[model samples]
Each structure stands twice: as C-alpha cells, then as structure tokens.
Target: MDDDDDYWNTSETKAKAFNFDDDVLSTQEILAIGQKSYSPSGPSEESLFNNISITTVQSAAIPLSSLVSSKVLDLILLAQSGKDPSKETKYEPEQTVAMTLKRLTLGRSCSLHVHRSMKSKTELLDGALAIGDGNAVLTVVLFLIQTLNKKLVYELLSSRPVALNHYIAFLQNEGKISELADLLTMLGRSPEAAMYQYQHTVKTQGNNVDVLLRKLTNLLANHFNQPGVDQHQAKMISDYIKLLEWQKHVNKPDLKYNSVIQWLAYNCTHHWHEGAGNAMSPLTLCQRHQITPLQYDWVVLNVHAKSGKWDIVESLFTKKDWFGRTTISSNIPIETLLSRLSQLQASKQLLATCVNKVANSDDRLRLAHMYKIHAVVIETLAKQKDRSALTNYKMTLNPQSEEYILAENTLRDNSIKWKN
Candidate 1:
C-alpha cells in the first residue's frame, strides 16, 4: 500500500501544475525548457510568452487566470479591470484566450464557448482609447480568426470603429492584404456582411495577400480583355487596385498633397505587369470628384513625362484665340495648347500662333522664353540656324519686356536638353 501511494504520487497526471512565479528565470534555462515543449525550431508563437521567459518549471502555460491570480500577469488583468468582464463591451484576455482555445479544439462543439469569451473580451476593450488599446485590439482582431470568435469580430467592428484604421494598418504589416479585398467584396454584398464574412475566413484561408493580389489582378485583366466586360467593370477593377495601393500608404495621415501620386507612379510603372494595364487613369477619378482640370493635367504631365511618353509631351507657351469680337488668352505654353504636338513641324506653327496672339508685356516675355527653346530645337534639328524662324522669333521678342529677360536668363543656363 505504501508503494502504491508513492506510485500514484509520481504519476504525471497527479503532479502539480508548473509555477513560473518563483524567480526571475535565467534566459538560458528558460530557453532550454522552452525547446523541450515549445520546440526551439518550431514555428512562431511557440516562443516564450510575452517578452518574458516562462518556459521552465511550467505547466500548460499557467492557465491565464492563475497568472492573473498570482499577480504575474497583472498587466492583462489591469487592462481588464478598467472595464467589467461580464459586459459584452470589454475584452478579457484570460477568458477570451481560454474560450478561443476551446473553440479551436472542439470546433462547432464549442462554438458557444468562443462566443461567450468574445463577449468577455468586448467588455475589456470598451472604455480603452484608440491608441492605448490599438495594439491589443488588433491582436484580438486577428487572433479571433483562429479562435473562430465571430462574436468578438462583430463587437469590434460595431463598437470600436475608432480602431478600424489602425486595424487596417496592422493587417497590412502582417501581409494579409487579401483580407481587405475579401472584406470589400462578397456575393452576399453589403459592407457589414462583407466585413464579418471576410474576418471569419482568415484562419481558414491563411496569409497570402501578395499572391492573391497577383492572381486577382491577373484575372481582372484577363476578364477586361474579353470583348464584353464593359468599361464600368474595368473601372471597378482599377479602383480596387488603387484602393489596394492606397492601403499600402495608410500610415500617411493626409491625402491632399499628392501622397498617393508618388505611390501610384512607383507602383504602376516600376514593374511591367500586364495586369497593370487594367488600372484606369487616376485623373479620371479625380475629375469625377470635381478637381480642376488643370490639377489633373499637372499630374498626368509629370507622370507621363517621367515615364518617358514622348507623344504626350507638350511644350509650354501662351495661346490665344478669337471668339466673335472678343479675344481670350491662355497662359499655357504653345506645346501644351496644341495637345498632341509631338511632331516637330506641328509644334512650329503652334508656337508661331501663340507668339502672334500674345496681348501683354508678361505674355511677350513668356514668348521670348518660348522662342529661346524653339531656337535650340531648330539648331539641334536643322544643324544650321533656321534663320527665317529665328528672325521671326527675334522680331516677336520685346527686349525690355519680361519675355526677353526671362528668355535670356533661361537661355544662358547650361542644363537645358531637348529630347523627342
């Protein structure tokens, strides 16, 4: 009977649970025991809990409550104590984690268990501010996926709209971009339904947003290539691509100063993806939003020029035209006025017309600068002074006008280069 009692005591099931609260464990010892259970070479999250080493002399992770009960996990408890645990508004880590684990292990058999934990978690997250609980809220947002905690997902979106932007940024950093696409689209439709449906699918689908983007982009490109997809569908695909790109820059707090312009330039042109062709011009969207035509023109001008689209390049000069008895003048340079003035000859008359129609000292001064660029172009193209055109230009320049001085200053500069 003595031996039987001893054997019973020695059995693994009867052993006391691991207690990590005894001392500040050495890093090496913690790592050693950690390797035994968590597998040193194993995948992530198997690492020591938190920024602390609690692997040595442990049970199954100290049942979160005991950690809180022992004051070792007070941060978790403190965060919870800020709000009630039973309310459907706070986030209780211990109960939440336990409920998640139960749902994961038992599947549908314990779905109710996960829902209950989600309610507990909601209470914990309720009163917290955006930046304070941002990380924790995002962590739960993601973890609830594997936990299959839909209750928490709904609670988060419905009550914690404050953290939605940060939540997007978190998902972006984690490289789960497909989450956004799925969140924005569904056969079911509606933003709320799409939101929850996509959140629920995370654990099942896994992370491969990059791959999904490539494939989806490719699919859309091919679909649009078909004869009947229609321009509207093509525009939808383009907007989605732009939205995806914008999400990449979500950390930027402002949008009015062309933050998106640079990103769009680099993303769409740096790589030669056939799918890239499917992206519609951002200028089109900007126009729809009631932005001035000039702003759209400016963006296209820089982007196309930088990307080396010669046919689209237009030289700048003043332009004027007659309307009945009235004359209206434009500040736009000659090349810009003619629209597709890529051909050298086409630009010449365009330039002449602009020079003849100038109505002011400022316009004439601008014309002198225009003439200077013309002279250089002619010299390069003809290998001799196009004396007639040069003489005509000289005749048009007003020496004391802003045009002559402005043209002279620019002409004296050493860096001007003309390219087709």
Candidate 2:
C-alpha cells in the first residue's frame, strides 16, 4: 500500500511538470471548447437579449405609419430587415408612387429606386400634376427629363408656362439649341428664337445654303419686322444675307461655303463700319475680313480667274501680303502666279516679266511646256542640257513632232559643245 501511494504521487508530479507551450490550441479546438463551456443562462446571453429589446424599442418609437403611406416604403424597410417586403406591405400602386415622389422632393438619395417603383405608375404622376400637386409635378417632370422621357416632358411643358420655363432652362443648360429655340418660339419670343435657330442651322446644316437663305429672309420680312426689335439684330440679319449671297456666288454647289460665310459674318459684325460704301473692292473686302494669303489666292483663282478678270487676278498676286502689307517687292516665287497667267494665255511680254521676276529654271521649263513657247523651251533646254530631261520632254510630244526634233537637236548640240 505505501509503495502504491508513492508511485501515484510521482505520476502526479510528472503530469504537473509537463510543458503546455508545445501543445497550442487550434481555432476549431478553441471553438469547440467555447461551445462546450457556453450556457443559455450566461451574462453574455442576458446582454444580447437586452440589446435586441433596446433596438426593438427604438424602432417602435418612430410612428412610420404617420410618416409614409407608401407600401413600397414599408416593403423597402422589410427588405432592409431581411424579410419579405412585398408580403408584409399592402399593394397600393398610386399611394406608393405619390410617396416615392414626396420622398424624392424631400432630398432622399434613393431616386433610382423611386424611379423603378414609379415606372408603372406614370398615370398617377400625371394625375397628380393635373390636380396642381406642384411638388409631385416638379418631381415627376424632373425625373422624366432625367430619364429622357421626351414625350411626357413635352406634353407637361406644352401649356404650363412655369413648367415650360423650367424645361427651357434645362434644355439651355444641356446645350440643346434647337429644342430651346422651339420652346422660346412657343413662349412668344419669336425673334430671339429665330436668331438661335438661324445660328444653329447655319452651323449644322450649312450645306443647305438655299434653305438657310430662305429662312433668314422670312425671319427678316415676317417675324422681325416688329417695332420692338433691335436695329442691330436687323443689321446682323441683313449682313448675314449679304455674306451668304457672296459665298453662293463664290463657291460651287459641291463646296463647303459655311466656314467662309461665317468668317464674313464675323468680320461684318465686328469690323464693318455702319456707313461703309458698297463700292468696296475685293482687296478691301479681303482686308476687312482678315483673309489669309492662302485664302486670298483661293479667291483669286475661283473668282477672278474664272471671271476673266486677269488684271484683278494679277493684282491679287502682286499686291499685299496676308496682313494687308505691301508685298510687291517681297521676292515671292512667281512660279504659281506665272502658271496661272499661262493658263489665262497672257501676253509674252507679261509672261517674260513674271518669269524674270523669279528666274527659276523649273518655272521657265514649266512655262515653256505649258504655253509651247519655242524661245523659252530652247533657252531652258540649252541651260539644262540634260539628255534624259530632253528625251522625256520629247516623249511627251508627238514622236515626229517639230518640238520633239528640236529638243533632240538641242541636246545633241549641247553634248558636242561639252565635248569641245
């Protein structure tokens, strides 16, 4: 018996001395232990029940019935509570729509949800608007506009001045110029509306120049002939007409003339003097309109060249620079000018003077080929003396032609001279 007791004491001491640090508890083991130790009557259970009761009491403190008559709101709350909202709330479509709009006007952030809810209740919204429910009308109208319900928005804004004004402001903010113009006209501001429509049409539909002209003429003759219209506005219209007429004459049917007309209109509006004479020359018009050198050349080609105004065409090339400064002695390459003159079949003296002004070999060759000038061709061929250039020039003409034979002989003579 005493040996047994001593052995048992030794075993107890060894068990007490075993290292616990090496045997860490895993998460599942710890959880199992926690579950085993848990009791329903514990302090944690009491605190949980107290918290739940407190939350229930707080929720019951607010009378939701008096605040929102919407079954949809009730359903939304039920959904947030993880319950079936549709089963708990009564189905009242009209009341739900009215409540949704009210909530929207009261600055709720659930507009998308409200819109979804009100999708099928448009008649309720319209009825509310008809009965002069200002709040509901504004909310629904803004919603329709936001959702791009153009048909409804137009219907609502048709006869309602206040609503129309709001829609017009919205269209203006969105840069819907055509819609804004139509609304403005409906509101009896026809002259202002016409101006906007005209500007818009000119910008977007400028290819329809005849239509634009007709519209402008009708506006001037019919709409803007009132006493209250500003004279400057009238002047603007008249200047636009003149500018359009000028562009119509200058550009072909296939050409884009809007930009040119816009430039003219800009200058006519800003730079033109009221009493400026109608006798203004093309150069004066160019100067006033601030035409670039490239644009000036285009005008000369299209207008002066086609009109048999050779002197005017020459003056365009000979006169001022782009900024209206005198460029007669500015050493411009007259190759292009000479080419144009050659096309017009100018006199030999004139061509010689122009060719002398630049004195480019290439220009002389081009002139010789362009006009079939024997003297210029012989001079250029002798100067260059390139066998290949002479051959190519001969090939471009008839094989047995006099010009070809002369060019070949010129090349042979130059080769003999070089050999000497």
Candidate 3:
C-alpha cells in the first residue's frame, strides 16, 4: 500500500518512470476509481427546512381566507394611519367618479388621478357636459390645461371641440371676454380673437365714449395689425372709428354749425375751416383719415340733416364761385339728396332748396314735378315758354289754388311767345 501511494503521487520522478503501455489500469481498477469518485446526491428537504422558524411555518399553514383578510386589515390600517395621504381611500370606480364630480360642482380643481387616467378624464368631461354644468366642464379643462403641455392641450381641445366650445361659452356667459380672447389666441385663431374683442367692446359700450374710442383705436392699431388679419376688414374698422369720432365731434355744443354760425360770419368760410389746426371738421377728419368726400357729404346730408342742423347741412354744400356768390357745390347728385331728404320727411321748402341748386333746367323740372315743387315747375316752364307744359301743370292742381291760377294766367297770356 505504501508503494502504491508513492507510485500514484504526482512527482516529476514518478511521472518519468510511468510507461503508458505497461502501466495501463485494468477494467476493475478503472471501475474502482470511478466508484470512489462518485459523490452523494443533494441534501434532503428536511435539512433545508429545518432552520426555518416554526412561526414562519405556522403562518404559511394559515387558511387562504385568513391570508386575504390580513391583507385587507393591513390596507385598512394603512389608510387609517394616513401613512400615504395621496393614496385614495375609495377603490370602487363608481365611488371615485362620484367623489371627483362632487368636487368639480363645488368649483374645486380636478383630482390629480384624472390627470394620469385618460378614461377617467373622458368620463368626467362627459358627466359635466351631460348635466350642462359649464363650471364643471371648465374646471376639468382648466386642470388639463395646467397639467398638460401646450401641444397635448392643443391636441385635446382640437380633438374634443365640444369642450372648447363649452369653455368659450362659459367665459362669454361670465362676461370674461378677455379670457375668451386669450383662449382663441392659444388655439391659433388670432383673427377671431381680435374680432371677438372688437365685437364685445362695441356691444357693451360700458365704458365712457373716450374710453371706448381708445379701446377701438388700440384694437385697430395693435391687434388688427398682425399678419393674419384681413386688411380690408381693418380698413372698415378704421373707417367706422373715423365715423364715430366725427359723430362725437359734431355733436359737441361748441362745434355744432348753429353754435359756430356767428364765428363763420366774421371768419372766412374756408372748406373744413382749413386754417384751424387740430380741427375736427368732417372734411378735415375725412381727408386726414383718407375717408372719401362722398362719404363725408352723405353723412352730413343724411345724419346732420336729420338732427335738424340745416346750417351745418348748408355749410357742407356751400362753396364760393369766382363772382363771390355762394353756390351749393354738392358732391352727391341733387336728385339723390332730394330722394333721401324726402324719405327723411324733410319739409317741401328744404326739398325745393335742394332742387334750386340743380344747374340743368330739365333735371330741375323733372325733380320739381316729382317732389311737387310747383313753384320751380312754373318758373322753369315759363322760362322755357312751354305753354303746353304750363297747361298740363294747371290741370294737376286745384283751380282755386294760387299755383294753379298762376299757371292759368301764364298760359292765357299771348304777350309772351308760347312754344308749340
């Protein structure tokens, strides 16, 4: 055995002496080495579980119902302890919805959980819309607007257009027009936003006239000056502002033509009182603002005339000729003035005054007959020596009337040459 141990020892001397052909082990020897090398299987389950505490074993042996009940108790105790205040107490879906909606009705901010759960938000919005509770809808939308990024919020509003409309209606109903404008601007509808502000300002007119005018001017200069706004619409707004300013200036007691008639008596009657710096005359303001002369004349004739300012009306048409005579240099046709004045129920004297301004006899006669200005008709007919026209004019009037009698005398006179 000692010799065999020395032979098996892995030394360089023993290794060199070993010959592979002569020292080859027999089958029984190889079998004996394999059997010695074989080891026991893994440890038994008893050894593995032996160190586990008896308490742990007993807990694992507990019934499934008891295990579940313990979990419930743990949850209940955790909730009562308020260890996690953010964790919701209610677990049922219906209860969660009721609690959220109740908060919204009281004008409270939406719960944070809805910010995470898309379905929850949709259901909440639907509930608000179903009941027509605008405040509630606004609450949810505002919450989304605050929590979400601009791109997401825009997508949300774009996809759910009803929510946007409800929000707009809520703002409008609350008279929060500025907020409404902001909402429109956020949605990339700036033109609508500008117009919205303009319409509201005009509609309310709650401010003083000067204050209102300033607001409109600000809108025209700043808001409507953007690239997307329509130039034509801005021009229209500018004209309206001009007209409003003109109307206000004209209504001033010191500026009214009747009030200023004495001033004109001594001072030369320059068009728009030309030399008066900072004058608010119709012609001055209109020309300065590029408003057309026709528009200025129309407003003066129609609006000022209705207000019974005949001096102002006459001053607009009154112009100086080379002979220093006052002539009615009306930019509008005399016929149009007559028709408009007639609709305004102007007196026949006023109508005849407009008629006598016509330079053409034919136009004057036709307008005079149409407007029943018999004096103009008789005068014009006599000047033309139209006995047939005079006779025809006589039959239309009462024989006892003065105008009819004059026509009869003119026709009977043979001293004047009567045209056939």
Off by over 4 Å in 3: 1-116, 123-136, 159-162, 169-182, 194-224, 232-283, 302-336, 339-350, 353-371, 374-396, 406-420
Model 3, 270-366: lDDT tens digits are 3435553545444455455674566656765666566676677766766667988556677787778788888878777777778888889999999
TM-scores of all candidate predictions against the true structure: 0.29, 0.32, 0.46
User: Which candidate order results from sorting by TM-score in descending order?
Assistant: 3, 2, 1
Q: How many backbone clashes does candidate 1 have?
A: 19
Residue ranges of candidate 1 with Cα displaced over 4 Å: 1-119, 130-133, 146-148, 151-155, 186-218, 221-353, 358-420
lDDT of 2 by residue, 1-420 (tens): 698677757967655443457554333333333343343454553454664765444433345455444643434445445554334556555436556655655667544344453344455455555666565566566666666556555665675665565556666667698777765665557778767766765776666778888878887886566676667788777767776776675554644455553444333443444344332344456654456666656544545455566665456455555876433332234666666667777666556555545467886677666666654666576776556666666777677677667866777773444322
How well is each residue in 178-240 modelled by candidate 1, as lDDT tens digits? 565343333222343333323433333324445444644675555444554456655655555
Residues forming the 10-long window of minimal summed lDDT in candidate 1: 376-385
Q: Pick the candidate with the highest lDDT.
A: 3
lDDT, candidate 2, at 246:
69
Candidate 3: RMSD to truth: 19.3
Q: What is the C-alpha lDDT of each candidate?
A: 0.45, 0.58, 0.69
Stretches of model 2 off by over 4 angstroms after superposition: 1-89, 92-113, 116-278, 311-381, 399-402, 412-420
**lDDT comparing candidate 1 with the true structure:** 0.45
Residue 240, candidate 1: alpha-carbon lDDT: 52
